[model samples]
Target chain A: MLENFKFVLSHTTHPGNIGASARALKVMGLSQLALVNPSNFPSAQATERASRADDILASAQVFVTVEEAVADCRLVVGTSARTRTLPSQLVTPRELVELILQQPARVPVAILFGTENSGLTNDELHMCNYHVCIPTNPEYSSLNLASAVQLIAYELRLGFAQTPELPEQRILDNEQPISREQLSGLLEHFDEAMRKTGYLKQNHEKQIDIRMNRLFSKANLTHSEMNILRGFLRSVLYRCQ
Target chain B: MLENFKFVLSHTTHPGNIGASARALKVMGLSQLALVNPSNFPSAQATERASRADDILASAQVFVTVEEAVADCRLVVGTSARTRTLPSQLVTPRELVELILQQPARVPVAILFGTENSGLTNDELHMCNYHVCIPTNPEYSSLNLASAVQLIAYELRLGFAQTPELPEQRILDNEQPISREQLSGLLEHFDEAMRKTGYLKQNHEKQIDIRMNRLFSKANLTHSEMNILRGFLRSVLYRCQ
Candidate 1:
């Protein structure tokens, strides 16, 4: 599936960006890299920037034009920070992941990244079926090219990576969260501790009780966590006596 | 919130990683960057690697000690590859995001990343209450320091940048976590006061010490709470004096 996708850098001014882009793609298990008229390919700066990912730069496919870069691609997605005036489907990085996952078997999916200053040209953007925008602060939406690639690549990997299923809910039957009785017991323990510390001299007991209850409720304490708390409280009570 | 999260790298080996980390944080709308005991900062390697993210590097904070770097921060989360045998709680990147979002208004939160070859040492890890681990392949879990920073910074941005209704948990509402320095001061004050009252004459100090530590740790006293406790202790000390 990684081999089928092509990440094309269009008119990239810096050779270092190309190298960094290669590293980003390789980390996410995406290997195919196509460069459309990079300023200086096969340069020492790029190889230095690629670090351990030199293989990506070595085997990179160089193209003279954007048209040649993504001609055979089944789907093309261009990355942009601004909302274009043209009518094209704009999706966030996560949403683009969902789109890619829904059709993993598709061949030659091209991700287009434009020049550093202006981003994808209108004609180049028109070639894409969708535009992918990484959500950033509206006040300062300037994102580095390689970083943008890294994020989009990460989303792709997360969508494709095989992860272990999350542990199933461990709640026992007849136990809906913590019972009111158990909550009251926990509150009493807290109140007793406060009293020992001379913190609940007034009717502040009610406020302390309410606050403690809220704290525990937010924890959604598991059975084991609850046991630990109870054991600690018991020890405290025994010491106070 | 964005301005408050300072990404501090300690003893960073690779200048490129520093640059990449800057780009990572910028893409996520976080700006503050700090370097503690870096091997070589302000090198051309770093500036070139930073690409257009030189602004972040230009304004980066350089500190000699991690303590100094995080002195102003109220919350400190250390990024680790795996959980150590320490009693510190392990939270995934997503959970850490939630925790950071729940921090009280405008308090600084420091996210610590160690050198590239060997991640944060036991001493550094001990400084943090929670260890945030980014789930990576166990077989080839060679995540670069900057990549780890990228993932965590991304999660933090997602958790805190959105404009949604306030979370129901309100976990950090009233309990502000006490700093290690504050905790140390309180412990010293307790010891002195106990000695003044003859509560620690015959090795009873050990038992009382353990109990007091547990009590304060469980309470999760904030900065203000620590001040209050110190104020109370001062009054008692005055009476004894």
Candidate 2:
């Protein structure tokens, strides 16, 4: 559900913020990034700031305008640090999350963030179904662009849990998420199969095993998913023999 | 309600993040920010990033360690982007907000955000009553330092609104917070009385007044308390006269 949301930054002036926004989106498991007429993109500074989040920047789609960036999106949300006399429905980030969850069918939702200086232009706000103002200190509300993105992204990630219980899956009921102990067994199987298949050379470093553990840990594999993977590993070993 | 919360960023590497963090806190109407052994501070980069919110940076209290930063705080909450094997009560950001609001009496609450590369060390995390995660993308959970503070500060603000009218506030009704202006007048009275009593010397710099403000700010004084202070000040003046 979170993957369908694309974070769109319009007329961003700093490439570093662009990079930071990418990192923020990725941290929350949201992948889509759209930049509308950024000042300096594809720059070294942006890359440096992105760190391991380079994949997000590399795959980031650049569009000519906000409309173009969110053309396919059904639900558009524009973030502003200050409240303005506007027509769009105003909601807090959490409220926006509840609003988004009401219609699960809305694929490819777009969350818009304006340039650092001024927030979304009037026209852009008009386009959004909802306008979100991060309740900030009225006296000193200079929220950096990427910081705004990070908070919204965090809220979206949270909304994933707040959403109404997902329709039950037939397979999921019988197969709970596998325990870490079970996952470790799967890794050992992979190590044995890979070693016999000459996939891992003699005197192979433990780094490969460590990475396999990390990769599987992220999979959040279910019991059935674990069986399928283990079955595939057995087949590979049989073919090698 | 939000005044008791204090944000602590530990072992921070970039001064810019520190300045950004100060802005983050102030914007949320949260005034307290404590830094633990930052790599660089009072740096030009931090000042530049802070923009007009330089006062938050200037008044920011620095400490040599996390323990010292949070020593005065009763409820310590640590931020973690990853799931660890530790035994602390892991909660979503919203849950932490709810928990903090549950006990309105827990003044000087500390929320700790660790360094950039690594999150809070096990020792540091153990110190927290709750381990809060912002619920980021599991694939790449690398939230920047100041951005982390911004997200937490934003939640704390929202939580303040969501918090059911604090029950303790009923007992505190007679002690409703006095404005900074009122607090200032009380400080001036203290200064004159102390001077008359041979404590403050002639042309003493404003350091004593500054310390008094810090002291009373923590007191969260009520209207009657302010009146008592003023009455005491009047008695002292009469004696001096």
Candidate that would win on TM-score: 1
lDDT over C-alpha atoms for residue A182 of model 1: 78
Per lDDT, the best of the predicted structures is: 2
Error of 2 at A158 (Å): 1.2
Pairs that collide, model 1: B176-B222
Task: Tell me the TM-score of model 1.
Answer: 0.71
Screening candidate 2 with a backbone cut-off below 3 angstroms (N, C-alpha, C), the clashing residue pairs are A27-B137, A28-B137, A29-B137, A137-B27
Native contacts retained by model 1, as a fraction? 0.09
Instruction: List each candidate's DockQ score.
Output: 0.19, 0.15
* Model 1 segments more than 4 A misplaced: A1-4, A67-72, A104-108, A165-241, B43-55, B80-87, B102-106, B137-140, B162-220, B223-241
Position B191, candidate 1: lDDT: 76
| Candidate 1's TM-score on the B chain | 0.77
Task: State residue B113's C-alpha deviation in candidate 1, in Å.
Answer: 1.5
- Cα misplacement distance, residue B37 of candidate 1 (Å): 1.8
Query: What is the C-alpha lDDT profile of model 1 across A118-207, one tens digit per residue?
Result: 999988988988899877766556677777777777777666666541212334442234566776777677566556544556345565
Docking class of 1: incorrect
